[model samples]
Target chain A: MSSTINLFMAAHHKECDELFAQAEQAVSEGDWEDGLFRWQAFADELEKHFTREEQILFPEFEQATGMTGGPTQMMRMEHEQMRSLVNEINKVGTARDMDQFLGLSESLMVTMQQHNMKEEQILYPMTDQSLTNAQEIIERMNQ
Target chain B: MNLHKLSLDTIPPILTPFRFFLSALLFGVLAALLLLYSREDFWFTRWSNSNLALTHLLTIGFMLMVMMGALYQFIPVMNGQLIPGSKKLAPVIHVLMILGVLALVSGFLFSNSELFQAALAALGTASGLFALSLLPLLISRLGNQLIVYLLRVLFLVLLITLGLGLFLLLGHALPELNLPYRFYTDLHVLWGLAGWVVLIIMAVSSQVTPMFYVISEFSPRYLKILSLLIILTLVVMSFYTVFISKQSGTDSAQPFIYYTLAFLLSAELLVFVFYTLLKIAQRKRKIADVTINFYRLSMFSLLAALMLWWVAVFLPLAHLTYLLAILLIYGLAISIINGMLHKIVSFLIFLHLQKLSLKRPEAMTLVPNMKQVISTRNSQIQFMLHLLSGSLLLISVHYPALTVLAAVFMLANFCWLSWCLFQAYLLYLESRKKILACPEISMSL
Candidate 1:
């Protein structure tokens, strides 16, 4: 199961999902202040999660597999798309354009769901199987 | 382990699924026209020529066609692998299925045993090729349990259902070779409606409902049980019908087994529907998109069918069979498919365009958002038309004249649906043309 690697990474997704729902709930109810606060927290957590994968897991995977222009490359490109989406979301400013926010937020959700599904279902298990010292890798990434 | 499965390449060109969607829409309209043509027989009898034809039109012609497309599109993303030969084999599979279903419809309409034989041969061959071509790819990606496992089971059951059905048609096809066990018909229907249809919908929705609607994962435990209960009921009923019927001849098989199976299946469906409604109610996003509206409508239709299914077991009410068929087949299954068609098509269009725009930066401005891909007004009209047809069809059971009106509404709904999807296609084409023209800033796709 690659308990450390898979669970640790997937838990971040669960955490981000919770915050995302909270922000969405707030916005749907037209609570801008709370919505912004929760949304910011979600964005920050999401960035951290993305960084963890991009820097640590994907590199370790690429090194082990030596398949540079494959799944990981696609993941990086999708990350770029998501990051650009997050950037646009951040620019919504103080005047709450709830419709646009929700629209883009929906996009972010789909992007994240697809990205996370591939990572959890495909990449993590593969990494778990191939890596000689996953715990050490996890420890290094944790640091 | 084929890492290529996880990449965008696994996602076939848009036409793969769009063709299926467009065909399903056309078939839906065809079903409507058939309904209008056979308005008298359609309302009068469930097993009559026109009624049987209409059911096939909706079931095999429309629903299965669309499902084949969606399965191809989603298998990769869902399992992190592409179905082998998905691109090349699709057209062949599509033609066979369309021809097979049309033959079945004609066989029923004309009471022609020859057409029945033709349908069995065509459909069996098509489904056999379908399984051989695609199931292996999906099976190899069994990275997780429960949902994936259920999907695998459903695929097998689907093949069995087709085989059993073909077996039944054989006696009629060739009067020279007689096969025993007349009750295989009930077994085939049990597997098709309960096992295959119910399980696949539950399995797909477990992932999709949460992903598309931004709802949390709602019903894993219950969904797993619901799927299992449906299968268990199917197996139990099959045993009671086939094996037990042999034990004491025709008299041994009682209505009680049928009664118990119906109750068990209907109860599980009730839980599933309620759980779905709960999630939709608790959904965080409340913008009221057409897809969301479709989801709500689908759940309610399922709920209505489930309730009526329960009642139909106790009292054999007139038109009860037709009512349940409409509710289950058209109301629940078709509505969900129609709802997903919008999301899958729109998302796929946006995805390819996004990928294209990334490569050819000059075409960035030409790229469309999800909304622009299909106008809200168009989908709203489609949904309303869908609701209108469903209502009129429900009423047509009592008044046969309204069957024509119901068919009109259903046909109109599908026409709008086809138009909406075509618009998305044109938008995609426009993006492609503009992107291809600008060769200056080309990145390899």
Candidate 2:
């Protein structure tokens, strides 16, 4: 019953959160290998999340609501912001600049969480309310 | 459908909250100076003029100012609904609050009826205007989220607190107006402190703790039930104050009801504080965070205050209530806000700068990271100062002779906080200038 976009997307958010937190924890404990592993995992999952929303969900939301330049656009902009932050984080991680990496991680964590909050709280619910094919969209997201 | 209102893009111009925050720092400084000027004698009684002035300065001037500002920013973000006409009205409300708090503080200090009258007018108008601005959002089609529900109740209690305050002020401004002064005063303090302030803190903490620290989320159902119970207890206590306690002396069995309510409140808060502490201690990403330090301090202070509250109920001591106030207000409430201020101010600056970077890719390099906006070193130093000052003030309750020393630390604490904020603001301005000077380049999202 809760297989709607809201539940699907929100579960993905929590997964990303856990992965990101594990990476940060590993880094804090000086486990560079595990840290980078977890960090890459988190980044990959996050990028996939963005792709799912930007590719499948947002377009459906825009077309269904006929509001192409609305919340979806803002979400798109925030996604780009997070992407940029993530790229910086990758650089810091590669350099093994622990302090800088941690700092950027904090920044990314906040940016990513707030972004996820908007998507989960506002966008996903709106998508569920407005779309008739939410299950299908979620299925596509899974694929 | 005005879906734009629900869009997360609607950040109030950053100055909306910053003005109130910087103003709060000024009040904190003023409170410190007032403590220095009044010396240890202000500790003798809660009813003393200077003590009342100091209390108002902290509660209304510092705490309420910051809380109101935070609300203006957070309500929109959380509920995804904009306050109507926030751009213009927010500044006006900020100015009115400044005037109102100053007038009220001066009225208390100088025993000036005219200042009390001025305070009444300014504060009443400001509260009314603020409540009006929020009315649309509160009544609108907000989701049945715990935060929205809590804010709705918090706002109602705030209005009641203000109404009681206004009546009390009227009694001061016009001595001939027969008012149940003691009764109303107790009720006002209870509603203001326990109802409005504590409730808002609980609501904000539930949201903030898990999100910021990457801890497990609080059970929303449990929190909602707890909030409702707190409100219900307050309602019952108010009725007791009105009917039962007013007619009887301390020896009456009705006083047991008072004790019971206090015990309930203390137990509830104990649960909140312990849970929060455990969450913080168990945070997965254990890093050297100044905010965590502040949170720990505030939680411990809350625990101490709760313990002392129980002791006060058992043994009627002169200094216990005063100690409880210090622990609650300065130690707990101010500590949390101070911690939040560091994180929030940095986050806000970083957010706005991020938007600028979006407009121009050349500016992307210019945006400072969150920690760079307020360096960890500076924030940690400020936290230490705050802890030292709060501890000294608590000690000054027993040894009034230490008031000057305590005031000195308090002054230093607030001044340091102001300087930290000013430093961040300067960094922001510097970054903005460098970014703006760079060639504008189109960036696609």
Candidate 3:
């Protein structure tokens, strides 16, 4: 059960990284149109991933453990931070200020990767261990 | 799978400090406008005493106030650990900052007066103290490299800029001070804008962009290195140019270096935009919230503003350059701030409401959605007003009446935003009261 959750999260992380790289390439080449498209795609993936965690995984965890606030709240806050950056990037993108855009992207990338690492290595593994009905949860999530 | 619930009471008191900062920002904006109006007589007079007043109001008063408030609220959330001094030191810093800004602005306005010189020294001391207060939290959280680096750089730049400004003030008071006023003045502005404001914004945004959208994470190493490199390059180039231009007695090389720096900065900004858009695009969430819409609009505007800047830099039209600056500063910067303000206010309110709900779920009835906390209608109207004012102000360079109209609209829009923020605050308090009245519920395990 734990392995499945780990695998799913790992795959998602990899996909996200790949998308980020593509966006970087587009930016470096000054392909605003394609860059915008790819970047939006990356943001979408993240939204979906977070939604699954918040709605499906988090609720189940809360029900099982009766602890509701800490992890979920932290995750939500991180989500807020990411959204703010996206908004900033969007603003900079509209201005077409390449230097500001690149600088912001570089900083954002680092913060996000670290956030993912904590979730992947610590939180997700802990969840997998605590939830005995993990297989069922994974199947439901997949479905 | 029960997660351990962290008590709301245990969370550090960030809201009180933020309120003080917000109040400071309000005053700062008003001060800036008043200073600008006073300088109407000699609008193009660079390095004038009145201009100094306006600059300080904008930078120290408005920008720093907001930045400090945000850091107070966000740092703990980011690190998953609360700052020890947050509850105690925030108020102290806030008082110092406000008094410092007042003193500094007064000093700049009365550059030649002995009393004003003393005031300036006091303001500098207050700011130094405020910076010192933040050192502990900053040092403890050195793990967040982007923020840490930005804070360090901002501190250094603040010292340089403020020191240069003081020198200029002394030079005004005592002509024998023998200061190279113009050189230091230019360097001061450059450092304040690029080093302090831009760097901090970059650092905060990196964490925020992904967090807001629940997007995949960014590459941390790349971000930290890029930010450091940009700052280093800008600092080196600014100093080199300042000294070289003075020595060589030529303005020819100035434009080249400025343009090169601008191009590099633009490239960096573009990368950020692209990366954020990519993350948002990949998000699985189907719901289109107000925050998301504002975020999208801001991103689009950033790109448009950048293009305009590029054109303005290359083109020979003075009016165009002025217009582009307005668009970039007021249009892009304000829009992003407005959007983020909406979300931040709403989220904070929501969190407070949820905390109350824990004690009394019934009291949660009045808790508003993110949209209700900030009226979308008001925001839309304000955004349009901002756009119109920006356009008019640009044209105002030729037609004086348009400038007055621009100022009027801008002020009105800002009032509307302030009202919305106040409304959110009231709602938050009401919700808190309801929670306090209700009986706490025991956890069901």
Candidate 4:
């Protein structure tokens, strides 16, 4: 039961990582149309992941732990940071500026990877332990 | 799990790590200057004062300085707990380390007893305070346990290395102490190089390679086993050198066992280099990142060093050993660090600025993105300088007269590194000021 959340969320993180690589590769290869398609797919998947955590998992964890301003808040802030970068990358995508797109994507990659690390390595495990209905919470997040 | 420990805000003030990074580059410049000043005499022997001074300057002055700074930033985040009072401890430790390295290098260059004593005091206190601050975090069972465990051993080895260093310094400061300089210094170098430096680099690679390069994680169980074997071999070799080899001083078999141990250690490092290269090649992100190139070059250097170590053992050439050390130190370790500095500094600036923008939403537009903070053009130039100087330094081992030319390039290499970092810092400060000013008008109203 405890391992379920870790397994589920960590898999989602890997899926997002794969999407990110595909998007980055397409852009690097100068396929603007395909690159934009892949990038949008990545951005959408990432937003959905962030939403799942923030809307379902985070509030549950917060309620379970009775702490509002903690790791979740930091994660929320990082989500906003990534969101801004995602928006910037969209602008770069439209302009088809390879260097600008690469630069913005690189920053997003680092920011997103580090955020996922913290969540997978620390927060998710804590979520597993702190919440008794781990399966149900993960189910909610899946939707 | 202390919930408060997970707060990313616990990252030390920007200056804490940045000061150390900039100072490390300056010391790198100092090292190159020492090379130019000493000229060919620096290559006279591994035991020469000039040689020792140069090694310390690069090792303690540059490599260790940067490592400590990275640790301050990395450990807190990785362990999910900040080192206690890190903001205060970091600056004091940075100053002491700087003073200590300079004093230690001076003691070697001039054979000054007072300088040696000063170095001992400064370094001893600095490492002591740092170790004390980091102990709780290292002991915690949070985050990645293997990395935490490896970090714990790194600190322990560092203490042993420091202890050996101080004993050697005592022999220099007070000749009457009559310490066996050769024996103790061998142990010191072994602990410092193989034990502390190599292990930390490998540990860092395990974490960074997967995260930054989009590769699969190295098998932790396998890594743990490999780490244990390396430590076991080091312990056995040290024990042989200290006790068994001395008892059977005339036995040719003793030297054979020593060489065998050395080969085994080199083999382990070879395995690490190959494994890392394979991972780098396997990275899903096929971007032409400068840092990935740095990793490849460093791995190549490591492979070269390992082969040279084997050759040095069989041939018993005086200079080949020196070349091996140079490859390991400058070519391998320093190259990886140089690459990391670019990524870490840029990301740090972006992170802090992002945090600031989060606080002051109006300032969001003012933040410089990561690439804007440190342009790829600047880093690519730094890479070329680093490669040229490193190649020249390798060649200087064979042709001693080229030492000055190598030194000049080395000086340029470090100065360029300094300029790159300084430019990024300037960008950070400029962006930070603009961000702060955004809130000013609102508050005034």
Candidate 5:
């Protein structure tokens, strides 16, 4: 119960957001190399965050609450949508299509941010409440 | 912990808000064209016959239309409850409102009693039905406390505004009431602008700008304070109008209370504009967007309007009030609405398409991404036309002939806006057909 699910997950979201912003800034400056590097870091961090939710947190929360389709379901769906966008961004980055990359990146950034808001505001708080063994879950998520 | 209370299923159909958006563009073009044909003397006073018609065409015809549609969409997002009978009521209200505003405008323009009566019936019914549609959702447990509070007040205030407007209209329609039409009309304007429009915009911006654009969240404490000041000012103004005015029987006290509330209202709006500007300046994304252009222009226009309004308090200038009204209504309000359309329309298209693709992955190949729904280049051109129109409008006050140029700009801007949305809608239709052609759709969250 002392795992601090909201703060820990929220901080990870912030980390991903910061990386995304750096990638975005690089693309804006027409530095495709830096853009790709930062974007890869952001994508990797995002995948880890998704794994923590999908593999550990969401299953645990669903089991505790016995609710399969709800906010988490929506979040998972949005994450899929974002993952596709990330793929498009990666494709454009490789092609060095600056205009295309910037456009796709802006779209991705909006989707990601709104998704984070919903998770941070609704899902994480619910996870904190429903999961009794939150401290262990946090340790596992950290790992 | 309230995740069960929130669901993405609560959102209304995509067409609900788009219907209003398209109508607003039509009305904007109409309002501009109406200004072109009106006599030169119409701009001389606030109460001139044609001026009344023109103003209502913009305020009721355009602004109110868009706001109602947005509320239907916003309530579900902010409250997590779909409004009961919304699908059934939205189209009905839209038709009623369009008919009502047209009737009202023609009545004002021609001084026809029959048209005034028709206007009363149409507008009154439309406003009532609009309120009825929101009743169920308003009673639900809203997640955001600030938005919940503001919406409750805004709903009530909208009815009050409509009721007062009806009272004034009756004097013109029936001619038996013999009311001081101007007296009640001012109160009607106050509640409409300050109570409904300003409050809702403030409440939405408090959450939306932060989330959608990745801007830093504003201090809710400051918003709470601003809300209180707004309510207090409205209460004082109402108290003065309803009670104190009859006792004094003089025009002197009216101007004092009016100016005081005006100052306080503008100050609150200035704070909103200032905060929005800062948020945009510090937004995480540095890439150029048509929506960002609209937002920046909206803030600057709002600030410019407030500054001009402040200057008029000390210096006397002819028709300065008209200029101030232009900037506040068209410059600030319409500009923000345009900015919001770019984002909201795109978001809806993007969200719905994703949902469709999720339902049938095979149909995804036919789906266009968000960036392709409404192209940046097309909207940028739309924004340029808007900027040119707005600038010409400001200068149109001194030289009446310039209004023709402004009208031309407005016509082009609106035509482009309509074209952009039409293209997106066509894309939506194509994607929708592809999804339907699939054998089985996965009906899941």
Candidate 6:
């Protein structure tokens, strides 16, 4: 179970990084169409990731730990911030202004890269260690 | 987009309801002070030292402070992750931000002096530190493209804005340096207003609008690109015009760009308002809360004000401009803040109480409904008074005496808001005490 969770989380991290890099390249080239597309893909992956956690993983953790109102809450707020920025980026893209797109993209890239590092380093490992019944849970998630 | 595991115990203390109350009170007092001291003659008369000081007091002191506290508490619940430095750093950031605000406000009111320079330095350092501390928390959640983007944009803009402000302050303090004050000031306002303030608002609105209404999530692709484009255009156009003005000396291009940006911003705001209203109309929850009502009213005011602004652009009437500013600042912004505060405070209290009840099951009854904490009647009265005061003040710009009455009414409204919040806090304390006393009974089985 632990290994499966680790594998999935690691894969997720790499995907996020790739998206970030793609977004950076697109913005640098001033190809806002591609930049916007990559950003949306990045956001979509994140939204799916969060949904899976909230619906599948978080409940299991809550049941196992008998604790609530901690990391889950923080993640939700961060999601809100990310969602807002995505909206802002899209707005800038529509205006088709390179400076605005780049300025926003620059900030988004830094924030996204940093955020991915933290999750990959800390949260995933912590979860893997704590959840003893991870194999069953992973199988259930797959099903 | 890693689904990391985290335990409930990892939640930070600074993200609790108590800290929110503390931040809110501090910001409220500072905002009130700005309102009391602000001169109508100089209000929006071109972003001067005093204007910058007052604006920062509202944006950094009031808005950002509240936002940080809310974010600290909220992020944990949203993401299942704890903020790394929330416990120790929250208070440190809060105190520094408060002191910085005081220094900047006093310095601006008094004009160029050693104290002003010290205040600017304190504020700049505190803001820098706050941004630094937020880096870890921000980094942890980078999987979410939308939030990561917003934070990055806001932080960068904040840095530029603050840096320019510091330069301007230094120039004022030491005139012998011979810095081009006008140039820096223009850039500073541009970064501060367009870059930091508007971008953050836009970023926050995307999440808030959907969450509040439970609407279908905004089309991420369109929203993200659109917001970035608008802010970027405004910022670049502002700097470009400024550069052009310096070269041409008698150019009106700056005003033209300003008008264009305003129109663009208004259009964007309209889109936001429409989406929000549409969602609200479709909300499954039939029973409307006070916060939702206030939110709806705020949206109406925002739309009306935007239209008025466009009209005034063509008409160029002083009265119309004053009216629009009042509607935008006092009407739309304040209304939204009021609504948000009511909901956020109540939700925080509920979350805290729920947590407490987990340990002490007997005190479950003590947890108050959100309605008890927020008084709709009081909010309604305050909103009406604000509208009345705004209308009167707009007319009173010509008849300056009327501003006194507007100020008086505003003071009363602020007092009422403070009282309501205080009352809510008291209720929260009482509820906590009851829960603590009956711990065994309140514990979750």
Backbone collision count in every prediction? 0, 0, 94, 0, 0, 61
| TM-score for each predicted model, relative to the true structure | 0.90, 0.96, 0.70, 0.96, 0.91, 0.70
lDDT by candidate, in order shown:
0.77, 0.84, 0.62, 0.84, 0.77, 0.62
What DockQ do the predictions score, one after another?
0.38, 0.57, 0.05, 0.55, 0.45, 0.05
Q: Whose DockQ is greatest here?
A: 2
Once fitted onto the true fold, the runs of candidate 2 whose alpha carbons sit more than 4 angstroms away are B1-5, B249-253, B316-318, B443-445
CAPRI band for model 4: medium
Q: Which stretches of candidate 3 lie over 4 Å from their true place?
A: A1-143, B1-10, B28-42, B110-119, B140-176, B253-315, B319-325, B442-445
Ten contiguous residues minimizing lDDT sum, candidate 5 chain A: A113-122
Kindly provide the TM-score obtained by chain B of candidate 1 when compared with the true chain B: 0.92
Candidate 5 segments exceeding 4 Å error: A1-11, A132-139, B1-6, B39-41, B253-261, B435-445
Writing each residue's lDDT as its tens digit, candidate 2 over A18-120 gives 8998998899788899999999999999999999988999999998989887789888999989999899989989988887888778888887777776776
lDDT of 5 by residue, B1-445 (tens): 2566677556788888888878877887788777767635556778887888888888888888988888777666555556665687888888888888888888998898889999999988988888887776567554555666667767777777778888888988987778788777877877776666666667767767766566666787877787678777877787788778756886466787778877988888787778778878887766566777877787787688778878888887777768867776777677778777777777677777766777676775565666678877777887888899888877878887777777778778777777887788888988888877876665666
- Model 2 TM-score, all chains together: 0.96
Residues B158-271 of candidate 1 have per-residue lDDT tens digits of: 777777877877866776787762557667766877667776777777778766666677555776666777778777877877677557777335777767676877777777
Stretches off by above 4 angstroms in model 6 are A1-143, B1-5, B8-11, B14-54, B141-143, B184-187, B251-262, B319-325, B441-445
Candidate 4 local lDDT, B1-445, one digit each (tens): 7765477546778887888899999889999998999888888889888888889889888998898888778866676666776688788999999999999999988989899889889988988888888878777778767777778777777787888887887888776778787777877888777777677777888888788888988888767777777788888887888788767764354677888898898888878788888888999888778998888888899898788777776677668768878888898889989999999999999988887777687887787777888889988987898899999998998898999999999999899888888989998889888998876323210
List where candidate 4 sits over 4 angstroms from the true fold.
Answer: B4-6, B250-253, B316-318, B440-445
- Residue A134 of candidate 4: its Cα lDDT? 92
User: How well is each residue in A1-143 modelled by candidate 3, as lDDT tens digits?
Assistant: 33567677767776776676677568757888898788889878877777878778878877776666666566665565566656667787778776666545644554466467556544666567678888887777766
Candidate 6 accuracy as lDDT: 0.62
Candidate 6 lDDT by residue in tens digits, B17-66:
35545655565555555555664653455455555664566556666666
